[model samples]
Target: MTMNEANTYDRYQRQIILPDFGVGRQQKLMRAKVLVIGAGGLGCPVLQYLAAAGIGTIGIADDDLVSLSNLHRQVLFTVHDIGLNKAERALAVLEQLNPEIQYIAYPKRLTVENAFEIIGDYDMVVDGTDNFSSRYLINDACVLMKKPLVFGAVSRFEGQVTVFNYRDDAHDEPVNYRDLFPSPPRAGEISNCAEAGVLGVVPGILGVMMANEVIKGITGMGTLLNGRLLTYNACNNQVYELALQVNRDARVSMPADKKEFMEMDYDCLCGVGDKGFEIDYKTFSELVRAGDIAVIDVREAGEVPAFDKFDVVNIPLHQLSRELSQIQAGIVVTVCQSGQRSLVAAGELASAFGNSKKIYSLKGGVLQWPLLHKKELS
Candidate 1:
């Protein structure tokens, strides 16, 4: 046997010995190209396994930096990687794990303008992102490119997996993500791992499962997850599979052309942008100390420990229009648990009082307040 063949045999002997996967399956894996978005929790396992499986070209797309909190779930990184770009750090570590594979690191956020270009080069895309904006964007882009997407999401103790835009041999029609979630959820209506707290193993399990789908897609090893949604509950180790059908209405939401898709505002669609003026916690803290602006907590009354220092008013978002008289100040700031509700409140206040009155939403809200205080202390 040739030296290269002998080396390849030594590398994948166990997998090669399997009746279903042999030299041909390994060759298919070696020729496959997959792009994984988000180098956080789910991305770690997906990258590790795909690299070890010898995917010919793997792309890592993420604009975020590693933080202290990510160490628990983002296994590809370490304490030393904190503050570094996730994609670059992930590339560095994966290369050490398997130098035979080719890795591309995109140290920038995926935007509509760039999504098509980057994703067009890959055979399939993996959705490891945690947010709706990124998820929808990747899904729409895959549909536009006619590429398959392996999607996985984790929340607290529950995780979900599905394959979108994939054509199965049994079905002539391909199923895309839009068929599952026709529209994005309203901002603050749903909380992420950062807000709700996810079990460390949830993303790990979901990510590995997502990687398996990708392998199946590349090698045609097993039944693909097309048209099926797999949901797993780590708390009880129970799993559920729901059959998904294409939605004509959902298909209409996709951008008609490349130009339109490129110009689509995913953030706005997801209710994740500043509709009104926004102020950082540091600046809001300064305003609070100076007693220049009134702080209005828009969260429901029973939400949390009340704000003690600044004479803040607890006006739930629903009552803001009726209780406008309670807030006497011309300049006001609206705040919520995580800054999302506050944005909505700020917009309402701005619209009600007109442009003459200044309104600002506390960016990052009460959740970020303590972090800012800690930074000040440090």
Candidate 2:
């Protein structure tokens, strides 16, 4: 390491002073590589602390943009970052916090194709991703590579944390993500934060826990939750840790190859595909500009103050099933008051139409639709 590198260790003085994590363990932290998969609710705190802890290299992968709604929980971005890419905003802040460590930003959505590529470079994968598809993809990829994943997920006020697919490959037994939830919950079965609501600090607690797990795993100290699940109920201030065992039925044979890691259709894998799917407004604009896809509005009729210029059919959610076939084998845009209905309807379309057709969920529904969406249809 160069002279500038020598000073990197000095930045972690506060943490270095902690018992068992003196200069020696601190050095390990400085040399460790960590990847945080999302920059949302759980991710903000996870990345924030990891950077501050002096992790040598950190990478963040998120394709979603910051929104007013996200600002309430994803503390990393502010109002000014409303439309900026999440990974970009997180990287900007993280870099400033600790220029001592190298920070990389994967501003694209984490997909099966790029999941491992994005995570394999790192030693620990901090899962802040909300959707099951991403979770399975990340877990599957990590298991295949024998990488340790610090997983944290929050639903409403309840949160779950676990360390799966650690370095210990004794008997080649890998505790896969399926061990937690054997099957993906149907789309819209559980209310997402945007629909149901979550306390601002819920993900923060879970995220910080994940960051702690990463730190412990890197330094090889503390009891890591390798085959256990830790659940926290902030509303009740109750915490529980339960041991986990590999499921014989779901003990996915250690992936046969790396291609398996990239082949999962998170759309279908996470049940999001079943509800249709989401594409960024920018991407929707691109597809519309190309003049190939049809946009559909699933919002309730008269539910919103209409100012749309997009050539979309106002097929209300209640009427979606009847008019389903009306939509061609083209990209469908689902719109709602904020976005919940559209997400639900989108999944409906995907399940029936299969993956050949494209479906996109408008962020924040029509509430945040960009002016370009109107300009294109007009």
Candidate 3:
């Protein structure tokens, strides 16, 4: 036998010994290419095991920076990695763990402009992103690209895993994420890890399950979660499987062509509103220091770590509609916990007072405000 073959056998000996998954499956894994959409929670474990299993090429995509809070779930990053780009940090660790595989880090958020191009390069895509906008965008892109997708998500004490766009041999048509979730949930209707808080082990479990689906897609080792969704409850260790059906309306939501897809307003469509009047924390800070814009905090009365500057007014989102007359400033901007509700509030304001007042939504809200201010301190 060749020296390379001998080395590979030794490396994956444990998995290779499995009756159905021997040298053939190992080689398939070594030839597969997979792209994971986020380097946080779910992506961490997915990237780790896929690389360890010798996936030939793996892509990591994320634009967010590592924060102290992400350490609990994002196992790939260290405390020293705080402020570093998540995709790059994850790539560095995975490369160290398995130098044999090709690791590419796209340190940018996946947008319509880049999603198609980036996803096209991979054999399959894995959805580990937290928000519905990104999740829907990835799912649509994968469907358009005709790429298989290994999907997983975690919230609070529960997680779900499934494989989408898998063409079952027994079936005439393929199933995708849209088949399961026909439309993106209304913004703020579902809580993300940041808002709801997931147990650290939850993503670890779901992520490993996602990795298994990817391996199955590559090596055809077992039945992929093509037409099924598996839900796991960490609190009770209970597992449930639900069969999925093809949704005709779901496919209709996808863009008809690449140009249309690139021009799609995913954020607004998913109910997070638009970036048209969104202001970044840094720019908003500058405006605040200059002192003219109306800074409306749309969080509830008791939200912590309050902002004391910018002549901020406290009006919860639920009350913003009735309290519009209370705001005295001309250029109004809304802020919320993590930006979603604020965007919704901004949209409402725009609809109510179209050209009469300039409206803007804080891009990353209170969660990102401190980070932006810290940069000024530095």
**Number of the predicted model whose TM-score against the real structure is largest:** 1
In angstroms, the error of model 1 at 141 is 0.8
RMSD of each: 6.7, 8.2, 6.8
Colliding residue pairs in candidate 3: none
| Candidate 1 clashes between residue pairs 3 or more apart in a chain or in different chains | none
Worst 10 residues of 2 by lDDT: 1-10
lDDT of 3 by residue, 301-352 (tens): 9897686644679998778889989877778888888887787787778878
Q: For each candidate, what is the lDDT?
A: 0.86, 0.79, 0.85
Clashing pairs in 2: 112-262, 133-270, 274-347, 275-346, 275-347, 276-346, 276-347
lDDT of 1 by residue, 1-378 (tens): 221677767877788789999888988888889999999999999999999888989999999999999999999999999999999999999999888779999998899989989998999999999899999999889988989999999989999999988876676677877888899865655667775679899999999999999999999998987889999999999999999997999989889879989889999998877344678877777776665577899888988655655678899887888998877776899888888777777777776788767788888777776744745633
Instruction: For each candidate, give its TM-score against the true structure.
Output: 0.79, 0.73, 0.76
Show how many residue pairs clash in every candidate, following the order shown.
0, 7, 0
Model 3 — TM-score against the truth? 0.76
**By the lDDT metric, which is better: model 1 or model 3?**
1
lDDT of 3: 0.85
* Candidate 3: regions farther than 4 A off: 1-5, 274-378
